[model samples]
Target: MQINTIYTRSVIQTMAGKAIRDLRSGGERELRNVAELCKGCSASPGYQTFWSLLENILRRPDQQYAALLSRAANDVDINCLKTLIANLGLHAYPNGSQPLPGTRESGTSPSYWMEPLDDIMDPRMLHQQISRLQKQGTSSFLFRAGQKPELETILNIAGKHRQCVFFLICGAESCCRAYLEEMTALGNVIPLMEYETLAPTAASLKQAGILFGLHRRYCEIESLQAEENLLRQCIALGCFLGVYEGSAQCPSQNWELACYSRLQEMRCNGAQEIFLADLWRDREAVQKLLEQRSGQV
Candidate 1:
C-alpha cells in the first residue's frame, strides 16, 4: 500500500512537471491549456500562475521577514510560526561555528540554520553547529534526516536543545519507513516531507514526452487512488511538513505543478503545519498569496 502511494505521488508529480516544460518551451502550441495548468505549477496551491509565484518569492515582501524573525524571539512566537529554518549544511560552516565567515549567509552573525554531523558515530560537528546557532538565539534548525545516523543526530540534538530541529525527508527513494517510525518515537524531532525540488517530476515528464510519457508512467504505477495515503502516514507519524525552494538559477515552473498537487492533497488530508525551506524568506509572500486565493475560492 505504501509502495503504491509512493508511485502515485511520483506520477502526479510527473504530470505537473510536464505541464511546466510545456509552458517553458514558449511555443504557441505549448499554450494549449498549458498556461492554465501551469498556474499552480510553480508555487503552492491557489498561487494560480508563475507570475504569482515570482511576485511573492522574487519581489519584496508585503511584510518584512526580518522583523518577523526578531519578533519571533519567544517560544510562543516561534511555535506560532512553526520555528521554520532550512539548508544548514556542513559546508555552511568551515572555519568555525559559522557559514564560512563571509558569504551571503555569514556564520559570524546569527545564522538561519544549524546542521549536524553526517557520520554515523560522530555528531560532534552537529553539536558545535547547534551550540553556535543557539548562542545566536536561533529557535529552529534544519537537518537532512534521511538516514538513520542523521536522524539519530537530530534526536540527540532535540533532547539537548529546546529548539525545533526540522527534518527534511528528501524522498521515499532515499528515506526508509523506519526514519519516520523512529522520528515519531522521539515525539519532538519534527518530521517533514520535503517539496520544492521539482526536478524529478520534470525529468519524468520530459522523458515521458509530456502526456505521452505520463500515460506510460501511469501504466507502470500500481494505483492512483493511494495518493493521499503518504500524507496521512506523515501526519500520523507526527510530521510538521516542510518544503524546499529554488535559486534564481532555477525556474518557478520547475516546482509549481508537483508542489501544488502535494500541497492541495496535503490540505485535503489534514496537514496544518506546512512550512517552506530557506525558512520564510522565500515562502511568506507565496503563502500570503495562497491564503488570499483560498479566501476567494
Candidate 2:
C-alpha cells in the first residue's frame, strides 16, 4: 500500500512539474482541480491542501509573493512532504496510532540539545538514540550542535533514519552551500538558521534548492511595516517556513499571543507554508494544528 501511494504521489508531482514548465512557456494549461487529484491519492487533508496550494499559486500569478511561491512549488520536495504526512500524521495522534510502543512521554521527546556526550557526538550512540526515539513513537526531532563537524555528523545520522524528520538549529557559517545541498538531498533534516546571520546567503542558498526556515526572536513590534518587510524579504529569498523563538523580553501573555496571531495572518494571506513553531511556549497548540492538518480527530 505504501509503495502504491508513493507511486501515485510521484505521478502527481510529475504532472505538477510539467504544468509548471508549460506555464513558464506561455502555455494555457493551469494547475487546478485538486479534488480530482485526490480521488485515489489519499484522504489526508494535508495532501489535499498541498495540491490546492500549488493550484492557487499557479493560477493567480499576480498575487503577493507569486514568484517566491512559484519557486517553492518548483523546489520543495513532494516526497518529503508525503513522508511527513505519513509519519508525523501517525505520530500526531497517539491513540494507538503510532507504529511503535511507548518508550518515553509523548511531545517531550521530540526536541534535543547536544548534551549527553554519547547520544549526539558518537555515530553509533546517535543511531541508538534515534532508534530509541523511534521506538518511543517520536517521529520528529530538533537537534542543536556546537560545531560544524558535529552538525555534519548529525545530518549523516539523520539521513540513515529516513522514516523520521529532524530539524537542525544552525548558525550561518555552519550552513554552507555544500551542507545545504546535502540536506536537500536527504529530504528529512531541515535546518533552522538565525535569520540575521543567514539573510546574506539566502538567495544563493535558495538557488541551490535547499529547503530551510529562518529562526527569529519574537519581541514587541516597534514597526509593523518593518516586520512585514522582513517577512516579504524572507519569502522572496525562497524560505518555506519561519521558526519564531519566544523571548523573555516579551513577557506579556497578550504580546505572545499577538505574535502568534501575526504569524497566523501571514500563513493565511499567501504564505501557507510559513510555519511558526514556538516549542518553548505553545507546543500543545502546534501539535493540535499538526493533528488537525493530518486529518486526525
Candidate 3:
C-alpha cells in the first residue's frame, strides 16, 4: 500500500507541476476568462456575488499582493480551490451565496478535528469515513491532531478524494522542507501551521507553490493593535488565511465580542481570509454583533 501511495503521489506531483506551468504561462487572461465562464454559467445572485468577490480580490491596487494571490490560485488544485472558496466564502461573506461545484454544506464544518489513526484502524476505514463525510457535504477535513507519520497516512487517504481538502495543522518543526514537499506532491492537503512559526519558511513555502494558512490562539489580554500587527505579519508572510482560535480561558461574552471586532476589522481589509474557530459557540451573539457592526458601517 505504501509503495502504491508513493507511486500515486509521484504521478500527481508531475501532473500538478504541469498544471502550474500551464497556468503560469496562461497568466491573468486565463484566470479572467475562467471567471467570465463562471459568470456566464448561472445568472444567479450567488454566482454573481462569488465572482464579484473574486474579481475584487484579483483587482486590488497592491499588484504584488494581487499577483501573489493569482499565482497561489494557479498553484492550488482546482478541486481544493473550489472547496476552499466555497466553504470559506460562506463564512467570510455571510450574505446570500451558493456552494461552488463539488462543494456541499458540511454539518459541523467541512473542517474538524480527527484523532490520529491507530494501528488497528484500517487506513481504509478513515477513507470510508471521509467518503461518508464528503457524501454528506463536508468539503474539507482539518487533521488538527497527529504527528508526521500519522499525518502522512491521513494525507494519503485524503488525497484519494480530490474533491475534498484535508488540512494538516503543524508547527515549524513538523513543517520542515521534506514534509512540505510531500504535501505539495499530495495536491489536496494544505498546511495550517502556528502563526509564529510561519516567518522562517514563509518565503520558501510561497516559492515552493504551497498554499498555507496560520493558526493563532488569541487571549483576553491581547490588545487589538497586537492582533492587528500579527495579522499584518501573517498577510506579509503569504498566509492564505488566518484561523483565529480564541483561548478557552477568555470565553467571556465581552471578550468574545472584542475579539470578533478585531477580526471583523481585519476581514474588512480584504487582504487575507480570516476564520473564527469558535464562532459557532457564540453563534447568536456573534451573528448579532456582526449584523450590528455591518449596519453601522
Candidate 4:
C-alpha cells in the first residue's frame, strides 16, 4: 500500500476513536494519546502538510496543532504562507481562507502613505511640511529633490509629530551627505534612508546604522564600492537603517516600505511622530525593543 494511503487510514482510525469516545465517557486519555501520535507523525511535503494533518484529526482539535502551524508559517518567511496556514487547515485547504494581502498578521496595521511632498526637497523642510501634512491627515512623505536645507526643515517638523521620513538616497556622495546632514539638523523624523546600491549584507549594512536596500542591477563592482563607502558613513553616524535587495522586475519599493514599517514599529510605539534626541539617547528603549524582537527563537 502507498504510504499516503496508509497514513490516511491511520488518520481515519484515530478520528473514529475520538468520535466514538465523544459519544461515551472516560476516553479522554485515549483521545489524548491519539493526538500525540498524530503530532509525532512527520509533516508532509509542500505548504499544506500541517493543514492536512490538522483536518485529519479535527475530531481531537489539538491546540498544539494551531501553535505548530503558526510557528511553521513564520519559519517559511513568506507572509502569504502564514496567512495560508492560519486561515486554511494544513492540507488541501480551500482558497480565500486567509486575510487579504497587504495586511500585517502580527503587529498593529501600519498607517497609509500620506500626501506626497512636491515643494519640500530636504529634511530641513520636514518641520513645517509635517505640520501642514498632519492637518491634511497624512503620516509619511517622500521628497525627491536633494535640497539639504529643505530636508532638514522637514525633519525638524516631523520630529515634533514623531513622523518618519523615507529619503531616497540616489545620486552622488555629496548629495547623500547633504541628505544626511539635513536629517541630523531636523533631529526628529525617524530617518529611513534607502540608497541605490548592490552590496546587501548584514555586516556591510551595520556600519551605517542606516537602513539599506539595493537598486535594480546594482551588482556591478563599481556600484558595490559606492555602497560600501556609503555604508561606512552610515555606521559612523549611528543611523538606523536596514538593507534591502531590489529587483528590475519588482522594484521592491513597496516591499521595502513594508520592512521600514516593521522596523519603525520595533523602535516606536506606533507614534505618528518621533524625535532624534529621544531616539539616540534612549539606550534602554532601544535595548528593550531589540531584545524583545531579535527575531530569534
Candidate 5:
C-alpha cells in the first residue's frame, strides 16, 4: 500500500536516545539558547533533525524543575551556534544537564521519550510541516504517550483543518490517562484505541486507513484461523488490514499469487482491503502494490 505505515525499530529508538544523552552530557562545553540556533537553521533539515533530538530530551522535565521548563530552548553548543540569551535574563542551566537536586530516593535517574517512534517537534514548526506534507497526500502524525499537553498544543496549532492527517499514538491507555476528558472532547486525534468508549464515532475516524495490531502474533495463529481473524478484525475496525512481510511472498506474486487462488480466497473471505506494510518502505514498490490493490493491471 502507498499509505504510510508506522515504523518503530528498536535500533533507531536506541540511537535517538543515545544521541540525546550525548548532547546533554556535553553541555559543559558551550551553551546557546534554542531560539538563536533555530532562527539561523530553520530551513536546514539536518539542523532541524538535531534540534528535534534536543527538544525531545526535555519533552517532560522534572515536576520540581517544571516551573523552569524550557521547551523551545536548550543548552546548546555555543561555539557552533548563535546566542540570544544575552539580555532577556532567561534562567540558564549553568550547572549543565543533570538530575534535579532534591527528590525522594531509592534514587533512580530520569528517562526521556520512551515511545519507539517519539518525534516531538516544536508545535509551531510541526503544524507547518504537517500542513505542507499532507497537502501532497494523506500523511501521519506519530503522537507519543504521556505527552498530551504537547499534543494539545500541536492540535491547536493545526487548527480547524485536520482532515488529511492520521494520528498513530502509541500507548493509547497512557494518552487517555493524561487527556481522557480532552480526548473525548476533540473530533480529531485518533490514538491506537481499541475500546468502544474511546473509539471515536466512525465518522470522526478518518475515511480509509489500515491497522497493524499485534503484528508479531500473526505467526502464532494457524494459517486458516489467521485468515479468519484478519478478516474479522478488519470488519470490526472498519479498516483495511496491514501485515509485515517475512519474505518476498507479496511482490514476487509466485508463492502468494497476484492473480490466482489465494486472491480468490481473500475475495471470498470478504477481504477487500489488505496490504503488506513492509512494501511501504520503498516508494516504487509501494506505488506498484497500490496499483495492484486497485486492480490497475
Candidate 6:
C-alpha cells in the first residue's frame, strides 16, 4: 500500500501526541494506547523523522515526561534515539529560549574527547567507548600502529564521527591481529580482509569472450557448468535461486540437483573455478539469497 507523506506525517503527529499524553498521566491504559498507536503508524515513510521528533519532545527536563521518554527510547525496536541522547545528553533538548550549557544554538554538538590509550590503556575504557559507538550507529573506525599518539588521536576522532563502517589499518603482526580479532568478535571493530592476488582461470577467459565466439559466449559450457554447481550448493544450503529463464527450464523436480549433476561431470573433466562475483550480480537476487540463508524468507 502506498501512503503519501502528508498522511504519514499526520499519523506520526497523532501518535506522538497520544504517546506524550500517556506519558504525562495514564499508566497501563496509556501504555496500551501508545503501543496501539505505534502499531498503526507506518514505519516505511519516515522512521527516522518520527523518532527524531519524538526524541526532541522527550528531551525536555520535565520530570513527568522524562520517564516515559527514557522508557520509550530504551525500547529495542526504537532505540536509535537512545544513541543520540547518550552522546548529546541533557543538552540535546533545550528549554524554550535558553540553550543548554554544552550545546550551541546552531544544533551542532561538540565531539567527544578521549585520553591517550598509552597513558591510560584500560580495557574497560575501550569497551565503554565501543559500546557507546555501537549505539550511535557507528560501524567502523581505523586503528593505526607504531605511533602511540597517532592511534590515540584516531580513536578520539572516531568516537565523534559516528560512522557505521570501520576499517582497521595497522602493521601486519601477530599481536595486532590478535587484538583486532578480539575486538571484532566483541562488535567493537571490523577487520579488513587480507589482500590476495587471483590468477585468471579458464572460466575467466571464457567470460571475456576469448574462449568462445561472440554469439556463443553466454553458452560457454564450462562457465555454465560452474554457475550451475554454485547454484546447486546454494540450494542444498536451503537457498532458493528464484525462477530460471530458458526453453529447457524444468519445474517438476528440483533444478538444483539437475544443475549439480551437470557441474560434477564438467568438474571431473577439469572445468575452471567460477568467480563468485560473476554468478550473482542482481542485488535483489543476492538480498533474497541472504534472507533465505538467515531464515528471513
lDDT for every model?
Answer: 0.36, 0.58, 0.54, 0.36, 0.33, 0.32
Model 3, residue pairs in steric clash: none
Superposing all C-alpha atoms, what RMSD in Å does each candidate have to the true structure? Answer: 18.9, 6.0, 9.2, 20.7, 22.3, 21.4
Q: Which pairs of residues have clashing backbones in candidate 1?
A: 39-48, 41-256, 41-257, 42-256, 98-107, 99-107, 116-126, 208-213
Better model by TM-score, 1 or 5?
Answer: 1
Q: Write the per-residue lDDT of candidate 1 for residues 1-297, one digit (tens) a residue.
A: 135433433444455445444544544355444434434332324344534433343234332222222222211112212222111111111121222222235544323333333343356766676666555434355455556555556667766653344444434332344443434333334433333222233232222221100001111223333534533343233233334333444444534435545544533332333222333333444334433432342
lDDT by residue for model 3 (22-79), tens: 4566666655655554454333454466567667655655433345546566655554
The digit string of per-residue lDDT tens for model 4 on 28-103 reads 4544453454444423232234334434443444323322222222222232222222211212211211111222
Model 2 CA lDDT for position 27: 28
Error of 3 at 57 (Å): 6.4
Q: Write the per-residue lDDT of candidate 5 for residues 18-57, one digit (tens) a residue.
A: 4334444444222234323433323334334534644543
- Model 4: how far is 273 from its true place, Å? 28
- What is the TM-score (0 to 1) of candidate 5? 0.33
Which parts of model 5 are misplaced by more than 4 Å?
1-118, 134-161, 174-186, 193-224, 230-269, 272-297
TM-score of each: 0.35, 0.66, 0.61, 0.28, 0.33, 0.21
What is the full ranking by lDDT, best candidate first?
Answer: 2, 3, 1, 4, 5, 6
- Residue ranges of candidate 3 with Cα displaced over 4 Å: 1-37, 41-44, 53-68, 71-122, 247-252, 271-297
Expressed as tens digits, the lDDT of each residue in 84-162 for candidate 6 is 2222221111110112122235596522221112333354565577556444322333343345444444444444444
Candidate no. 4 TM-score: 0.28
Q: lDDT of candidate 1?
A: 0.36
Model 3: weakest 10-residue lDDT segment is 94-103
lDDT of 2: 0.58
Pairs in steric clash, model 6: 139-164, 140-165, 140-166, 141-166
Candidate with best lDDT: 2
